[model samples]
Target: MLVKHFPGETIGIIGSSMASALLAQEAGRLGYRVASLVLQEQNPVRQFCNWQTICPVYDETALRHFAGRVDVVVAETGLLSHQDYKILAAITDLTLSDDLMAITTDRLIEKVFLDSQRCLVTPFSMVTSLKDIKEAVEYIGFPCVLKTTQRHLPQSSDHVILYSEEDYERAERKVEESTCILEAWIPTEKKASLTLVRNERGEMLLYPVFEVIGSGELHLKQVRYPANISSMVEAEMRRVAQVIGQALDLIGSLTLEFFITSAGVVYINEASVGLSSEAIFTLGSMSMSHFEATCRALVGLPLPDLLPRGRAAIALPLVDLNYDEVMTQYMMRTDWHFAFFNPRGHSVEDMQGYVIVIGDSIKHCERQIELSRLTHHPK
Candidate 1:
């Protein structure tokens, strides 16, 4: 049986994003009042979100005030300051803070489960001072990732990889201002994400494993599901994800990133504490919205089994609007579909264009995306 939280209550979200907006819509659809705390009214393209219409929280003062008004607070944007989580945690009624300390401490939220028998973690140490850096290097060796401990950069990627003593020296200087995690970079053959929801009772409902295709784009990359990775690797990824979930005492929805190296080793990367819309999109394209999954999880309702409905689906972010003239090039394609669109004249800050394509095969889908890029992308 699924566990339930407050029914028909309002749920608060921090950050104005397509993910938050879609999540808010889902909550409202599920009979709960939804309010999003955001910084601006204008839609800023959330590098990590799909749908748009996020509520704006313009400033720190606004965020503090917004936190006091909602019953349940969820931070969708990874861009959080310490003040954000502190304010949300202060709201005793009910609150879900994302990987605030996980990112801030540089401890992969997955590391919270290092004690578990299921995990094989790399040698790592916390960097608190300049001296700690030397110990970390001595212990973990070179070619390690130096990252802040907080989830300060939720929507985008941050942190530096040190491959030499000189690189480590520069990264160590920044350590005094933030908690850093020092860990060996695992070179994996493939990468995947496990998005799941844990009921209040601690039972976990694992979503289908989704493959993460690396992109040169900082955070606005494409993710494909119904992965091509080994079923064994997928199973192990799920197993490790569950271990991390239980260890963190994670509530509601979460996402765990992993590296499945050519050697068949699955190294846990990071953990996301709130709803993962990117993974949700993969599921959404397949069948149901992850937004619905979150809503159902929040209310303690049994989740519907998700089956792949579409064979191949792709989402391309409209990053530059100035190239509006080029849109006609993609509009010419017969194989693509506009799953979502921005109202005419309504502009987005981070991304100005949007298109979603679903085809009969991944090859067709990839071809459409490539073709669209060739025609519309600015030279």
Candidate 2:
């Protein structure tokens, strides 16, 4: 059963990442008291939250006590174990359900669930041993990616791309160490995602689709709102997202990432519950940001009317830049919005901060991104 929270009620947040901080800020704006459970006393989220509890999520007694003090709990890290889920469910309402977590946490299970819904997905095969690697390669062909099936694996590089037989031999060794899944690498023309919020009543609200532009290494480079896609394609993507959300009985926000091939075929890449990193780009573009929508859904509030401001692009730095330096340089440009997560020692690869540029047109946004890239990361 779903739980409801009213204004003035406390919202407990799990994890201490930028998403948690953003959620706390939005919840506070809506008159909801926010408390965060953090693993460290120096967590950045602590500054935005009303109360901070320093305790590991797996510590049942501590988690139960934390839950008792809040009306609902939202997890941002997506690192909760089954035991952790059990403890949270027993004490407080979770933004994501345990059953949904079980399915989405594992890449294989998530793919299977999408397939069961008759949703188109990338060609994939599950590999449990070295022998399965050859079979997977034979079916998926070369230039495929082998990803670990381990739920919540903390390793930064969980997937390896294989382009040749020699690469396959190396991938086979890597796969043998753990269960893996082989997926054919689609020559994607564009990568887009639809972020939606769903309530227990089956009501749904859709945000404008955004194109995910990535660097050569697959790190997010920029996100462009109102994806460069046709109306028909956008409608189909929204329909698929709605179907998946309704199928899971999603209680809060859900994001469905899709790969659009050159032929215009859309294939499901993955789905995530709660907040996603790319959603930050929606801050100034949408009437209701993803964080606000998630908070509203969690507290049983009606969805707000989503209206777009203008063409917007979110640029993520590929190299670390001094926050003050970047801000000082762009301070005169009112069209640019800056947000630094304050992950002090983290590299650009960690997605620490982003710049949002709103323009009169998409071409203008692209020009801004190119100019900023050249200025910040010159060749």
Candidate 3:
């Protein structure tokens, strides 16, 4: 069902994530009332919400009561189960699609959907045991990642890359512990991500692709707007993004991460239905941030198309370990835009703060990056 929202109408936000809080804030700013449900200990939404219900996310009674208090519902993915999706869909205007959730929440299922849509996907095959993994590796090739289908497992136990048979020992426990899928790891010089938003009428919006600069091991570094890729690669990424969005019947926004090789081969990594901390750059870089754009898309309002407003923008995430260094630079770099999270739901490692540097061109941002010593820990 197509649901259109107007000012003063209650928009029910159904998660405690920062993404949900950001959405609530935007909905409120747009003249809409924001109602929220959150867990007590972690309540980023409480400060922004007009009306709030505090409870466990899966509590049926609480969920129903919360649903009834608003006109439309939006949830940050990972907060709801397949059954919960059915429950909420039946009772209220749940904006996130159950099919999309069902597919995206499971890596194997998501890869299958992407394949069926004729979108590029990393080569993969499910492996159950040492024998299965060894045989699969022959075709999937070396330097492949072994990942558990279930994401809720411990992070360490979930993934291991197999470069050879000796490496299988590292992944043996994961393969034995859960249903696992092995995927060919595309060696790449650049990692890029695209955010896509779709309205109820099936209209969609694509934000500019972001190029993520990280370490050789893929550790965090910084993110630059409008990926420095050839026009052909960018065009193909956009083409697949539209196909995936339309196929998912998306009623909200999601991000797709892609691996771009030095040779310019583009391989889809994975899709995330939940809010991405990586995309926080949109806040300082674009004319319309992802939060506001997602709200507008959900309510059947005009989307601003998320155009880049500046010549270039880069986002640097801060952590607890960098306190002294960040502060020293903070004093010197008054021009930098620094945003600190509310210390509500976020752990220090997830993100203590972030700095966004926007300039007239990529050259200017590059200069700022050197001044900030973004490549090294604040010393």
Candidate 2 has its poorest 10 consecutive residues by lDDT at 316-325
User: Tens digits of per-residue lDDT for model 1 on 1-379?
Assistant: 2234565576766665566656666677677776655556554323223222334433566666766766666666466655656655665233343443443323545365453445766667777776787787786777888776665644225667888877856786667667776777777777777788765566666766776555665235655655677888888888877876676665678777777778888776766677675653453355556667766666666666666656766555545322453356456755443323343346543234334566666687678666555335455
Q: TM-score: which is higher, 1 or 3? A: 3
TM-score of each: 0.77, 0.85, 0.83
Q: Model 3 Cα displacement at 288 (Å)?
A: 1.3
- Total colliding residue pairs, candidate 3: 0
Q: Give lDDT tens digits, candidate 3, residues 266-293.
A: 8889888756556767776777888888
The lDDT-based order of candidates, best leading, equals 2, 3, 1
State each candidate's clash count.
21, 0, 0
Worst ten in a row by lDDT for model 3: 214-223
Alpha-carbon runs more than 4 Å astray in model 2: 55-62, 216-220, 315-352, 366-379
Q: For residue 21, what is the lDDT in candidate 2?
A: 81
TM-score of 2: 0.85
Give the alpha-carbon lDDT of every model: 0.61, 0.76, 0.76
Residue 79, candidate 3: Cα error in Å is 3.9
Q: Write the per-residue lDDT of candidate 2 for residues 1-379, one digit (tens) a residue.
A: 7667888999998887666788888899999999988887766577678888887544778778888999898876456655676788787787677668776567788899899999999989999876787787787888898888756565524678989877867787777677788899999888889999887777788988987776553224667787888887898999999889989989888889899988889999988777776777777666777888888888988886788776566555524444544666466776566655554355644435566777777788767655655335333
Query: Evaluated with TM-score, which candidate comes out highest?
Result: 2
Task: Compute the lDDT for candidate 2.
Answer: 0.76
Residue 321 miss distance in model 2 (angstroms) = 5.9
Give per-residue lDDT, candidate 1, residue 354. Answer: 36
